[model samples]
Target: MAAQLPIPIYSSLEDAFGGLRTASGQSVRWANLAQEFKSRFGREPAYIARAPGRVNLIGDHIDYVLFGVLPAAVEHDILIACGPSMSPVSSNSGSVAAHNLDPRYVPQTFAPMLKSAPLPTASEERDAENTVHAESWHMDIDTKELRWESYVKAGYYGVLNHFFPAAAGSTTTGPHPVPVDLLVTGCVPAGSGLSSSAAMVVASTLAFLAVNNKVVGLTKGELVEMAMENEKRVGVNSGGMDQAASVICTPDTALYITFFPSLSAQPTPLPTSRTVPRAVFVCANSLVVSDKVVGAKTRYNLRVVETLVGARVLAHHIGVVLAPTERPTLREVLGRWLGFYEAKNVPSDLDTDMLREGVQKILPYVEKLRPTRDDGELGVTMEEMIEWSGMPEAEFRQVYLSWVDVEATHFQLYKRTKHVFEEALRVLRFRDVCFSSEAAILPRDTLIDLGALMNESHQSSIELCENSCPEVDELVRLAREAGAFGSRVTGAGWGGCTVSLVAEDMVDEFIRSMKSTYPPYKYLGDDELREVIFATKPSSGAFVLKL
Candidate 1:
């Protein structure tokens, strides 16, 4: 006898659209029934999933470094309708809705899943017994989701797999097949650095779990970890904040989250109670897409910090072994071991002696090699130094002392980076103060401060953090001249969107000015650029509603 299948309750299209429109402010006019969504399986839909988009307000290029970031869920979302197929008409049409599902929508498998009975929901007892099996299933789903959708899909699959592997996993040679039809649609802008991608993944995961009647067994921390792992499966290499924000944030409040091995969040109220003098942010496109540079920068930053810290820890261990008479301060020992050459002033003749001498004093705490000094006079550029440290990983691995000594350079780099970061943080705090005070009531002044910070952040990112690109610089310039209060590159830098804080009164004016001045050159022409600028805002994140 066939196992009793969970009865799928399909929401009316009208209800789905109504709930979606209310939540996202996006219209979901169902396409022609016959053309938009045709079932490839002879069964009805059992469930639906909706995911939202997100925007990062601060902490760009810091996620891969395992640093904390502030992100908010936006009003934009991706809505997916999944259920049993009612007909085997090969719903493989070239429609907009079909295109959305193309990435993960496997027509053949979906058709079968719809035909078979839905898997039974796991009880608490069943969950405990199948925890290991469930985890394996989650990993498989994570892998499958990564193939076509954004990293978010990978996260969703991971959670589902961990909680309900039997149903989520694919199978062969079974009379009852696993067929799940997914129809996806969304309004989140792609590649906007708003983390729209992550939001969608998180929302979808929740929706999928809801439909399957599976419960997350882990603590809040474990749940976030699972979500982050799912995202990693998609190869985007992001932190867990986006998923956290999507699931945990509330309207009108910014969430402050700290993520290490686990996730913890608190809502920090906006400084002011009044809505006037609203916080405005603008976005500009850098017109370049170099994921490799962005990814490299992220990895490089992480490696530098780890290497430096690791070297220091190791040096402390070595200190314990040395005899009192022969022992030296960790700093002195490191300086001697790494070949210290000078202090305070790096000499003009930057030979091996100088390089060794310069690194000597701090060698105990250092972890990587400093980039060769640029000229005999000016030291090596920070970017050059970071790139150099990563150059000979294999050779450095062969020699223990050489490797640790070379690794010490990263310690110095991190210290320098931290100083710059501190300044930026100070500026942000000041802005918050200004916004909370009289400036909150004055719209124009608020914009001026916001813009100033935007420019300040860009300068710091370029000179201190070393993450700016020419396109970003150009965008900032264009935005400022066009009456934008402030504009800077968003995301991991090298290339991405630039966000500006503008006045509500001047938004239209600023948009018009930008359109006239920059004229929107590449992929999107002037008209498209105009449209994008007009549409962006500080929006809400993901949510679920009965339709």
Candidate 2:
């Protein structure tokens, strides 16, 4: 098995800071919040919190299923500078001074804060939820004005509800018990299938805990749980992997993690020599949103797993022990027997012995359902099943047979992915720099190897997974033609983004070609067409800057 990414940590702060310099082009100056606190409250600031956005290079849409995903923190991060608030300082005072005031910062009072500011235009408000805005930040206060910052505030409230419910009782009243005044900022691209929202939630939890002086006492497991609960406040049902990855990932290692109610992370290194190669990943937006497809597929996958689990429970009643993976085969067998029993072409109802034989005939087909090579090929092309279904009978048969062949191919491809990742780990282990290797090496080679896998993955996603759309397919082709090493659609397919690996030397050429070939259809000059091609590398998870 491939090694997983690590859970992020506070100790990685220095390296995380280094990564941020590259991302934001501004060196992080840990806010001298302690000094600011003294000036504001006549006391030292109590705590700090940091959170990072995540990029899924491969294995998109698999994390929520408890399946493995290859994601890492990007250099972009959200840092909260917080301290106890005091009355606003007098403008005439040349020196700053702090005085203790009520800690209760009522959320409802936020409405009045909005009234003090101008309202955003109707169009700006509609896109504000997912897209970033500059002018709108100064607009009227409504739930929407909260934008990215709201996630943090909501998460803080969530933490409060979880840890101090009595204090958060509905009857409680005050300046609305302000937990913290968070100054949030980040560089992670929004709506690109990167876990920007998850980072915000995780970082918010960390900030809340830090302000309360609770981080030092909490165990790693406790931290992950706290972040998970915080995300629940946003109404997004997610397994804790994204938060865990942000919290625990080291510099050069990819943390392979497994989560139940808690988390376990095993850091794996990349394959490389002393001179680690510089690599880049090209993220090409297909201009398609993934909400509906990703959501539906997630639910469907969950339902299938649940049904299989229920089948296993019933099988145990008949004195048979079966694993969940085996339930689908068993169900198929039962279906075949039922089909035989109801066959009008047959003279009579089949006996158990005959039904058993019918099941035997179907077993071969059931077993072949395992993922295949063609699945990987199809994934690359971004094709849909409906498209294939429209083919003529002879062509369909040929495609169907090729599809059958994909099962074995996909099994081999999965094995190949595991082998490459493991070998990369071995290389890092031999270097005796496992920790740094994770921070540096793994991210580079993983992108390269992952790029290769992406080609195959996209092929399979299109052919077998049956989630490809024409626009997505065209984007993949455009990326490859633009000189990407390999390209594939990321996320739940049918449209989202296509992740590509571009050689260092070809980066400029690739960008130029993509821009010329795929010009914006909706926007003209001066409109500042949103960048469709983004270059990224592995980065650290969230953290707080005490500026």
Each candidate: RMSD: 12.9, 14.7
Model 2 poorest ten-residue lDDT run: 91-100
TM-score each candidate: 0.63, 0.57
Off by over 4 Å in 1: 1-47, 64-66, 84-135, 138-147, 150-153, 165-178, 215-223, 260-262, 269-279, 290-416, 423-447, 519-527
lDDT, each prediction: 0.47, 0.47
Error of 2 at 169 (Å): 6.3
The TM-score of predicted model 2 comes to 0.57
As a whole number from 0 to 100, the lDDT of residue 353 in candidate 2 is 44
Model 2, residue 220: distance off in Å is 4.2
| Candidate 1 structure quality by residue, lDDT tens digits, 1-547 | 0001121223454343345545243334333211244543333334445555555556554444333455555556666655433334444210111225444444322121211334435542233321112343322222212233444345445544565344433343322212234556665555555555565666556555544444233243454455666655554445566666666655555555544223456554543233355545666655565442134424333433443433333344334233322322222334444444335344222332333343443433333323345443222333444344343444324322232112222334443334233432533443354446543345445456546665776776676566677867887888888766567766656765777766556777777676666644444676777535643443343433323
Candidate 1 lands at a TM-score of 0.63
